[model samples]
Target: MFSHRVAALRPSPIREILGLVDRPGMVSFAGGLPATDTLPHPRVDLDPTTLQYGPSEGDPALRAVVSENLRGLGIDAPPERVLILSGSQQGIDLVAKLFVDPGTPVAVENPTYLAALQTFRFHGAAFTDLDWTDTPAAPLTYVVPTFANPTGRCATTAERDALARACTDGGVTLFEDDPYRELAYGPCDRTPIAARMRGGSWIYQGSFSKTFAPGLRLGFLAASDDLFPRLVMLKQAVDLHSSSLSQKIVLDAITAGTWPGRLTDLAAFYRRRRDTFDAALHRHFDGHATWSPPDGGLFFWLRLDRPVDTRTLLPEAITRNVAFMPGEEFYAGEPRLGTLRLNFSHADADATERGLRTLADLLTEQ
Candidate 1:
């Protein structure tokens, strides 16, 4: 028979809503997928012949590119330490499978990534949250730190210091999941918590899905040497290796000097869109809504001042042809009824303003 944990995990809420917004003309801010138009053209000329099995670690060129990027982040990731993943999502599962045992204590942000929670839950890890004041024990803690999902809260430099101290003191390992690190649009100043701590104590996972193209499904993890080999073996058992083809393509793209230019352009582009959405949210739904401007990231967490539960509001909003993620889906146990997340990446300038207007009008009438 199959494992019980396999049956216990729920499908990701965002994944479930993906198809719903696929109707011919619907505007989507649901998926965390990056804007495809921003990715650089593939530079690696695929031979169509070398499309076979890749190295268990990753492609040499890709590894080199990743290693260079890691150095920029202050992590001394050798090529051997990098294991290319299908995406950062798969890296989450691999970590969970290797580090999380059934009933083992795992720490997570109060409002964390739904998929990471699902991955750990499927691996049968028991989760405890890092709350506003609660200090956890020697557990494995998971955090987004920068532009946290559904909260738009970037961990402050002070919070980063405190988190590092907690992890070091509690003898806990920190999983820094930073997919939206490069999308900063506002005043952002915080170093990675992992960078602040001792080596091997913090496991950092990053993805090209947000910065580059998601279909490439490219992600890399930087950890201490102790954790790298086991994750590589776990990855080898799972998917053997992330596609060599994708790796080469990304490598070529990065080395060609397009990735950096595109990154700056992408950040500026998203920043404008974010500012527009923030203004629209204020102009249309100012008093009744509450949200912090996301300094860098795709989604903005919004809390409605009234009793209008997002779960309750979704059906009506959908009928009226507007939709957003309910805040509760990001929670571990009970969903936050009045909270919701609005993704500003997918929508263009006009669509963003229009979508926010529709939601605001609906709320005003309600």
Candidate 2:
């Protein structure tokens, strides 16, 4: 027995496949898990407030630190507008609570984040493409403009400007998710859409999950005046507030002088992994699949030049002790077959190369 809302919920495809990943000697590139070796351990100096109940809007000092980081990236965020979340995942859930009514229209990018899709589906939102112009403006437009997951495609600055202008002109709210900016091989390729928006409603979400550690479970969104208060209200209903100890840890890392250097070191490390994977891809699957190399982020998205469905490829891959994400699960509507996502962040270079060669051999048989 369950509520009507429960009927709408579906498990995340990534998490669903992760159960198969924990098998002995399985080299999983399936989940969006960050490299464990790269995570930072900031000095922990806790205060009594960390043990006490804190504001649902988040700790003021941590919010200020998050606000300042956003400002440096060109978003016009102040500490006042920033509502700290348990993670950006919670941010998505709170957003679903605030704006998504049953049958409400929501526009999301094709092959978008599966967790976001699952959350909105739980709220009964009908999904559409980002260009939801056939009807009146969709209430929300969600995207990860910089180093997007699954695909790892960064939007061009021109494209970002056009999107900002269109959303501002159409009276729609833009939700720009930017978690992978700090992991860029070079300078971040695109300016934040929030910074470029011309007097329009928007939300800019950022997280410590990618660059730092997901266990911290700390992230935030900067919203406009109209949306921030209600988001805060929903957040209060959900968890009252995020972990005060997590807030202290991240705030310490950011405020301390070591964070920037750590980011630089991380970017270079991910870049090496990306290069290793890219080389193996070329050596093995080059003609069998087509893909654009991601400048940053965890995955390499591929459109296989064959007739096989990736959903059918999983069981065989499991037997081979290799794992990846089938791309169809990322779609809101019917999926485009023959596509998949491979993660380059978790395994070491030699393991990554061997895994890719095996994946390539699998693709070649079809």
Candidate 3:
């Protein structure tokens, strides 16, 4: 017999949509996958020792690299505070394991990242909307402040500060999941909320999945000294440590001095894709749907002009040889039927145009 947690687990709707997109001639705007062509594949030299098990906290060299990167983001984290995981998604799971219990109230943004909802739900976290004025007394709150997934909205500096203050005053721990911080298209001085908070009040999760290659599955969590040990222990229980070879490869890549230039190129490439997709959306469905043009990131969260259940519309979109994620999966509570998220990063400009046009035509028919 399976445990209740296992029983409650449902397959990710987005993952299911991704499978449908594999059909012949299907153009997808569904998955939040990074553009593979933009990823850097620098040569990494490894010794036999690099293949062995590594430190539970992470490889020291990799932690130092992550620490330096954090400093660039205006966060004052030292190598000692960093715990590397398979990916930032594991960071969410570790946090949930350590903190959340059945019926534990956890504050989450409305229509937040679906995987996060799934992670917290497995731990039996009772979700509530994050509100500064009436902040949830939950011990932890999870937020993707920079170019958040699905919506692609970045929280302003003042908003970050307000949330930090609320969390500090409420004794709530903040989990800042920042996978898209480096992907901004234009000038933005948005800093991590953890940078402004007291040392122990926040834990920050950063990933190479967006900026670099997702297949490497490299990510790190920076927490206060008090919280670091517990996380390492949980990580040890999970997999002993993340892949030793992958850590060395990431370290070598960053140390090689190619990372900075690669990041700039990645940002520029994604910006073009964003523009192309934005133009297509406007040309095809200007008045039929409304969406905030993302400043940076992979997605455009669109709200249909009329009430239409996206879940119901998905089959029709697939029938039209275009696929997109329905909005219901992104919500922790009752979902808004009119919203849907479209990702432009993985698809090329021409494919994006074709997909949007086909999608718009299908919606028009409905």
Candidate 2 clashes between residue pairs 3 or more apart in a chain or in different chains: none
TM-score of each: 0.93, 0.95, 0.96
Worst 10 residues of 2 by lDDT: 130-139
Candidate 1: the clashing residue pairs are 184-296, 185-295, 328-335, 328-336
The best candidate in terms of TM-score: 3
Which numbered prediction scores highest in lDDT against the true structure? 3
Better of 2 and 3 by lDDT: 3
Each model's lDDT: 0.79, 0.85, 0.86
CA lDDT of 112 in candidate 1? 85
43: Cα error in model 1, Å: 5.2
lDDT of 2 by residue, 214-294 (tens): 988999999877788898999989999999999888888887788888888888889988888888889888788899888
lDDT of 3 by residue, 1-366 (tens): 888889889888888888876688888889878876876666767698988877898899899888987877778689888889999989999999989999998999888999999999998999988875555567889988788877888887778888888887777888999888888896554699888886547789988888888889989999876677898899989999999988987888777777788888888999989888889999998978899888877889999998888899888888888889887778889998889999989888878888988988888888
State which candidate, 1 or 2, has the greater TM-score.
Answer: 2
